[model samples]
Target chain A: MIADYGYVGLFLVFGIIFVAGALAVSWFLRPRAPSPEKNSCYECGEVIKGGSWIQFNVRYYLIALIFVVFDVEILFLIPWAVIFRELGFVAFVEMVVFIGVLIAGLVYAWKKGALEWQ
Target chain B: MIIPVLTLIIMLIVGAVVLGFIAVSAMFLIWWERKVSAHIQTRYGPMRVGWHGALQSVADVIKLLLKENITPSGVDRLSWWLAPFFAVVPVVMVFVCIPFGNIFGIELIARDLNIGILYIMALTSICVLGIFMAGWGSNNKYSLLGGMRSAAQIVSYEIPLVLAMVTAVMFAGSLSMQKIVEAQKGLWFVFQPNMAIAFAIFIIAGTAEVNRTPFDIPEAESELVAGFHTEYSGMKFAMFFLGEYTNMFVISALAATLFLGGWSGPFLPPVIWFLIKTYGLVTFMMWIRWTLPRVRVDQLMGFAWKVLTPVSFANLIVAGWILMK
Candidate 1:
């Protein structure tokens, strides 16, 4: 198992070098013609507005929170799903119960209007 | 020779081939998408370059390479400079595990990692971090909005996508791509009733994952003026574009592997079968991209959270029950 992950590490290092090479090629060939106006952020021909990274809606964060909850559910479910056939009905029931809990969470999120976009 | 030197030689060979595949396929897919979208709109796509514009992407690449690399003022130079690599490198890492084919009774895969499917999914998600960094690093409001939208969209859709993948994991009993393909030797998973549902959900969620039309709120030209990539130009923009198309290929290849049975067919060679199925899905995605319009942000979020996630979760549970019995 450790050996398997060793390849991932090697792949990652090589990948970074390869991407850097692609960028280096572009850097060598691409022109350098920066100007005050050219370097400004594009706004469809409009002048600069307020800061771009200002506070936005809270709904996205809510959705992200809900996703995390389900993500954890999945982490538990994957092992169950992988070994599912060998475990038979007992594991099936266990998974159903586990899913039932998540479903309840989903329903609560739904009723709470956490899923609502508006 | 030392063991480390031997390993290094093997890695060098594999890395070159995989990177070459990525670079070549990205160029081809760009030209192909243009032709497909052009024909969809009833226009001549690229007639001037090499045999009906097949070489158009080659020319485009040259132009991008020669164009000025613009670093917009007021940007966080660190993330700005590194964003393209972040967008690309992870995707390239995924190629290591993909089973391209078997030749002379030897598998053509790079590394064939045991945790292939999980590893690919994990790496693909990291591309979102790069996009967010690009938006934040550029110090542009539209880029930020685009980046945030991408984050929201990707996160919301990932559940259904993973759940859909889990169905296949259940059927195959392994996460290795080659084993998944081998498991489907008897029958492709998409043929099963529940597996069909999983396949459908996978495609829908996969479409959203890649941020194509109907799910492309992040880079909606009409709304965000190129969205998270609004501030990027020239070669940097090219990198993003290449990453997006290559990502499209990766997901399609995943779909092909899980549902359609990677590299499996009669008469044709294994690699050909794999490419055919992979590119067929790629073409279908292009068709959908051209056929559909972008959805509202609310509608997109609603679809993922309200509909897809629930249905896929239920599907997973049901598939599990049936398999268990």
Candidate 2:
């Protein structure tokens, strides 16, 4: 098991190396001519307006918040699901209850308009 | 000392093989997708490059590598420079857990971690961060919108994706990819009625997870000018392209392993079976990408949160109840 994790670490290192190596090779071969117009931010060929740091839609943030709640619920569900057969009827019922509560929460969120895009 | 040195050498070779596989697989998928999309539109895609444009992706890679590396002014140097690496590396890391079946009596996976599915899910989630970074770092309005949309879409669909996967885990009773495959040796999970729904949910949410059409609003070409990657050029853009196709492969491979029975078939080799199922799913995704129109952002979010999420949850409960009984 420990050695298996070692391979994972090795792969992580390998992944970084692969990306870095590709970039390095490209750098050595690629051109570096940077003109003012070329380096400016893209705005569909029009003159650059103000910066792109304006306020974003709150719906994105709202969706993320709801996702976090359901994601956490999923984190709990995975372990229970793996051991469901062994744990028998009681654990199954318990998980069903847990999931039911979360579903209610989802429904509540829906009714509250958290899921609506507009 | 001898053992440690031997292990180091083995690790090095495995790393190189995996790296080569990632590069080659991404290139092949890109070429395959072009051919698929072109045929759907009644046109020859890139017949000039090689026999039926087989070498088109290779030429494209060479061109991208040789092009100018443009760093737009007022961009965040750290995030901008690091975004491509961030995009490519996590997808690369996912190869560590993929079970490619045994060949010549040798198991071909890198490491079949006990938490294989969990590990993959976590790594894929991290991909959103890289995309968001690219959007923010570029200082381009379209990029930011693309990044934000990508983030929101991935997170929303992930609920159904995970729930659907959990249904499979429930049936398999193990999180390891190899164990899951072993459990399906007798009868693949997709054949069961409830598991069929689980499989459908997995595929649907998975298509969304990878940002393919009609869920590809994040990088909608017409709307966002390539979305979060609009400002990327040269090798950086190539990295993003590689990451996208590699992500598609990972999703397809996972679907194959969980539902279609990974590497288990009659007569032919296990690796061949695995590739056939995975590439079949990939081709399906490409076909859908070309055939369907992109959805409105509101419609996309509402569909994930409203329809897919609830159906998956109901399916999970029904599956759990049936299994318990």
Interface RMSD for each predicted structure: 1.5, 0.9
At residue A12, what lDDT does model 2 achieve?
A: 85
lDDT of 1 by residue, A1-118 (tens): 6556666777788777876776688888877877888888887777778667678889878888998898888888878777788888887888898888888998998899987876
Instruction: Name the regions of candidate 1 deviating beyond 4 angstroms.
Output: A1-3, B2-4
Kindly report the interface RMSD of candidate 2, rounded to 1 decimal.
0.9
Error of 1 at B51 (Å): 0.9
User: lDDT tens string, model 1, B1-325?
Assistant: 6987887788678777777888899999999999999999999999999999999999998898788878888899999988888888888888878877786687888877777888887888888888989988988888999999998999999999999988999999998889999999999999999999999999999999989987889999887888888888777888899889999999999999999989888998899888999999999999999999999988998899889988998898888778766
Tens digit per residue, CA lDDT, model 2, B136-219:
999999999999999999999999999889999999999999999999999999999888998998988899988999999999
Tell how far residue A18 is off in model 1, in angstroms. Answer: 2.3
lDDT of 2 at A1: 82
- Residue B193 error, candidate 1, Å: 0.5
Task: Assess each model's interface with DockQ, reporting 2 decimals per model.
Answer: 0.72, 0.89
